[model samples]
Target: MFIIPAVDIKNGKCVQLVQGIPGTEQVVIENPEIVAKDWENKGASILHVINLDGAFGNKSKNLEVVEKILDTVSIPVQLGGGIRTVQDAMDLLDIGVEKVILGTMAVENPETVEELSNKYGSNRILVALDSKDSKVVIKGWMEKTEKNASELGVSLQKKGAGGILFTNVDVEGMMSGFDMDPLLELLNAVDIPVIYSGGVTSLMDIENLSKTKTFGVVIGSALYKGKIDFIDALKYQKIL
Candidate 1:
């Protein structure tokens, strides 16, 4: 599995929040494009970029930074956050985003998923199945739903999403280990590619995750905080 680095932009800066909470900025840096290039230099094969401001409904100029990041790096980038409309997803993909992730849009306007899939091919679309308290949450993890991750994964896969981005919000950004059973269940529930993110603290976490069937894992605070070396993640990805 690929150990993709996350570049979450909030209020025009690269910030990693704890559990997707607004005030808990663990790693904040200026110029996200530089961070993107740095991650690629450290041997990341792909990047997971999120617009936190967009996710929370603020109209920030983060897209300009995203454009700069696209201009800065050659590796494929998959982005999520505030991509609510079909035009929004198309604009990002037309501008060079390899994949556009859908959250609330996937649940509320599922037909759009099929529309995008038919228009751009399924491989360009990823539906996020982020869970909190074992229930799926959207709109920056503030809006909760009764549906669980695996249930929604099956639904979205049928909608023609090329992949599933499963973020276990219960353990996200805490640097604590996570249980793999729920993840395994989601993996068993869907035939599409799955990308996981959350509490990954050490090389052991990487090794353990590499043993799973996920296509990749998105590491943010742990990588930015230097808990796990990016080069080491790449090594384990190769060997496993």
Candidate 2:
């Protein structure tokens, strides 16, 4: 599995939010591109970015930050949050982002997911299924839905989604290690690549996740808070 570092942007700074709560955020860096370049230099093949400000509204708040990162790194970047329309996805791709992740759009407008996947090709479109207690959450994990992550993953796969960014909302930003049981179950439920996110804490978790068939792993608070070393974790996962 690929060990991808996360850079969540809010108000142009890198921040980590506990359980997706806005009030529980802590800034990790003053300049996100500096951190993105550091991760890229450390051998990150892909970077995971989330626009926290955009997720809460329909605005794209972190475009400039994202553009800075794109200018700094050669590695592929997959971005999500506040991307609700086709033009939003197209604009990001036009700016050299490798993939655009659709979260709320996938749950709220399933047809748009299918349309974008078909028009842009599945490879450039990712469906983010963020869930808590088996219910998919939208609007930046602030609203719960009746759809379960697994069911949504399967549906997105059928709709031609390239992959699923499956995040466990209950464990996100907690540094308690990933809730792997649900991820494993999700892996069995869908044939598409599933990128595991939330609660990654140590090298052991990376080692364990590497043994699974998931496409990749997204590390946020664990990497930023010094709970784990990216180099050592990648070494343990046999990536470097």
Each model's C-alpha lDDT? 0.91, 0.87
TM-scores, in order shown? Answer: 0.97, 0.95
* Alpha-carbon RMSD, each predicted model: 1.3, 1.6
Quick one: how many clashes does candidate 1 have? Answer: 0
What lDDT does candidate 1 reach at residue 74?
98
Candidate 2: residue pairs that collide: none
Q: Quote the positional error of residue 223 for candidate 1 in Å.
A: 0.7
Candidate number with greatest lDDT: 1
Per-residue lDDT tens digits for candidate 1, residues 81-151, read 98889998999999999999999999888999999999999999999999998999988899999999999
